[model samples]
Target: MSIRFAIVGCGRISERHAQHISNVGELVAVCDIVREKAEGLAEKYGAKAYTDLDEMLRYEKEVEVVAICSPNGLHAAQTIAALQAEKHVICEKPMAINPYDCGEMIKAAERANRRLFVVKQNRFNPPVAAVKELIDAGKLGQIYSVHLSCYWNRHNAYYANSWKGTKALDGGTLYTQFSHFIDLLYWMFGDVKEVTAYTANYHHQGIIEFEDTGVVNLRFYNGTLGSVHYTVNSYQKNMEGSLTIFGEKGTVKIGGQYLNELEYQQIEGIEIKDLPPGNPPNQYGNYVGSMSNHDHVYANLVQVLTNNGIIATNGFEGLKTVEIIDKIYTAAKPL
Candidate 1:
């Protein structure tokens, strides 16, 4: 029997989650503040619809999993509610807007004896996976430094009258646009030990409450140094999202706009070749987000829930992502 699932937020990203859930599990319910959005996904997936998440959680007792695709700020409350109701949670990235909320979500899940999964789907990208394997195998040796670049264009219309640009809901550009990249940084290197950043609104001054562009320096717990350059003001479209690693033994770069391609690699007698093709980046009308790996995410969910397999990304890892972002934001200085 497939695991029964319910989705809380019926936004663009929710559609992707629902699609994957439908493939691996049964989408039993969908909820959104906008009844129309909830009803729309419900109609397509043959699921029930409700405006209130609690109502749906109460009514849909068959829902073994709750996928939280709501805004960054709403994630903690919604996830805790679902966990308290005895359901595992699969939260979209950044976990929560802040680390305290993330800790609370984990505590709730622990109290309820349920699982909490965070969407760090980008880690499943073939090039990313290959690099991780190499690093773990000491192919990269003692890492010295790294660079992360996120240049994506959100434009005015993308944020217009939506939660995309708000400080309360969106939780800054790192949370919404580049947290996955940040997650990659933490996953490969260890935790960030220090951060110094300068940020600016740049093009979206009157549009977004927080900075649209930032230059950040990081020192990892292992004493590895790094820099992150991110912006949503790229001309016309997303230009690139890349991570370059420099280490004692080798250098490798996972480049391309979505970090889908292994742009360069010169290991000490190792090369990444013949990687299985990965899913394309998620296209949301004019803009594109990270690589589409929700399918892998749901598959892992099923494996863990049904077969006692290992979880790809757990709640603690999720909390670390939020913690790192919190550190960066706290350390940011206006440009």
Candidate 2:
């Protein structure tokens, strides 16, 4: 039997969710403040449309899972409400803007006895999967340090007439632009023990409320040292999103425009080969970068819901992602 899904935000990301939901399950309803956007997606998928999420939740009794594709700041409230309505939730990344809200969302899920999954689709990238396996199996012995780079362009036009750059809605470059990279850092290493950072609005001064570029240093709980350099000031398009690790036994770099390529490796005796190509990056009007791995995400959701399988990204993991980002932003000082 197909899982029944409903969407609470019919934005660009919602299209990806709807497409994957249709493949793995049925899209029973869609909700958005903009009537046109809601109706547009609903009509395309043969699902009911609504301008209010609460009303949709109340009426769409068959919706087993609610995907929260709304703006960053609204994720916690929307997700908590859906969980209270006795439906599972699949929230987009960063989970929530702050750790407090993320904690509340987790509490709501526990109280309601519902599942809360966060979308960290980059984890499904074949190269990422391979590297994770290597690290887990101790190939990267005593992982000493790691470096992350996110050089992506988000022209002024991309933020115009949308909620992409605002502090209240978008929650800064890390939340909207590079949370996946941060999550990968945590997933591979462990919790961040310390953070020191500096940020600036080099190019997007009047456009975005927060920094457009930043540098960070992290000390993971497992004694791994990490550094991150990120920016939306890359010339005209996304330049690179990569992670390089150095350890006692091996060195590996996962580099590409996205984390889709296993660029370099010098393991002790293991070789990563025959990695199947991954899905193309998601495109929104003109900008592109969010890896299109929602199919894997939805598939995992189904496996966990129906087969008692392990959730690829659970609520606690989602909360940790936010907690790390919160620490980074809190440590950040203007450069």
Candidate 3:
């Protein structure tokens, strides 16, 4: 039984979602507020195009999974609606702008008895996966500290004609651009017990509603401390999206434009071997972004629905990512 799919937003990321869904499932319909965008994707897949989500849900009863790529604020409501319509939902990152909305989404999934997934595809990166395995195998020993450095460029032109950089819909830089990095921090370091930080809108002050740069210090439940220094004010291009984990036994750093390369690995006695190359970066029309691993996410979704395998990044983990972001924002006020 193939998972039947529908896409709620036909933006840049939707192309990745549709491409992967076509491989693992059937694309029954696509919906967007813009008719042309919806029609374009629908025609490409030979599926129905809808301008309204409700209409798509009511008509496309065969759509078992809805992949939402809408704005941050709309994620929770749209997810709840899809779940109520008896469809599982795989939402694009951040889950929601705030934890409260994330909680509501989880509740709706529970009430509707449908699976809710969040796209944290970076977790599928080969190097990142390898590091996680090392930690799980107790090879990394007791973790001590983690550092995340995200220095990327988001210019005025990038946010010029876009809804990005808004408080209401797009949320801040942490939610918009660096959420995946923050997700990795939570995933690798563990639950944040405390955080203190500061933020600034150094470059795009007039353009974006929130910070273009920030620094945060975190203390985890396991006594591991972490720091995050992120910015979209890179001089000309994206400098790096890298994570360095220092532990009792080893210190490993995964660095590259998209965390695809294993920059450094040093352990006490064991050797890390034979890591396949990570996924290539996602190429949007105007800009290049994170690793392109939505295929793995879809593969997991297929196995979960058809073969009873567990969801790789389930709703709770997704909520935790959002929760951690909220804590950072609450602690990191503007300068």
lDDT of each: 0.93, 0.93, 0.90
- State the lDDT of candidate 3 residue by residue for 258-326, as single tens digits: 788899989989777799977888886556789999989999988888889988998888888888989
> Candidate 2 on 1-335: residue-level lDDT in tens?
78999999899999999998988899989999999999999999999999998899889888899999999989999999999999999999879999899999999999999999999999999999999999999988999999999989899999999889999999989999999999999899999999999999999888899999999999999999999999999999999999999999999999998888899999998899999989999988778876799999999999999999899999899888888988999999997
| Comparing 1 and 3 on TM-score, the stronger one | 1
Residue 121 local lDDT, model 2:
92
Query: Model 1 misses residue 107 by how many Å?
Result: 0.3
TM-score of every candidate relative to the true structure: 0.99, 0.99, 0.98
Q: After superposition, how far is residue 17 of candidate 3 from its true place, in Å?
A: 0.7
- Give candidate 1 regions above 4 Å deviation: none
Model 3, backbone clash pairs (residues 3+ apart or across chains), number: 0
C-alpha lDDT (0 to 100) for residue 240 of candidate 2: 92
Tell how far residue 70 is off in model 3, in angstroms.
0.9
Model 2, C-alpha of 34: deviation from truth (Å) = 0.4
After superposition, the stretches of candidate 3 with alpha carbons farther than 4 Å from their true spots are none
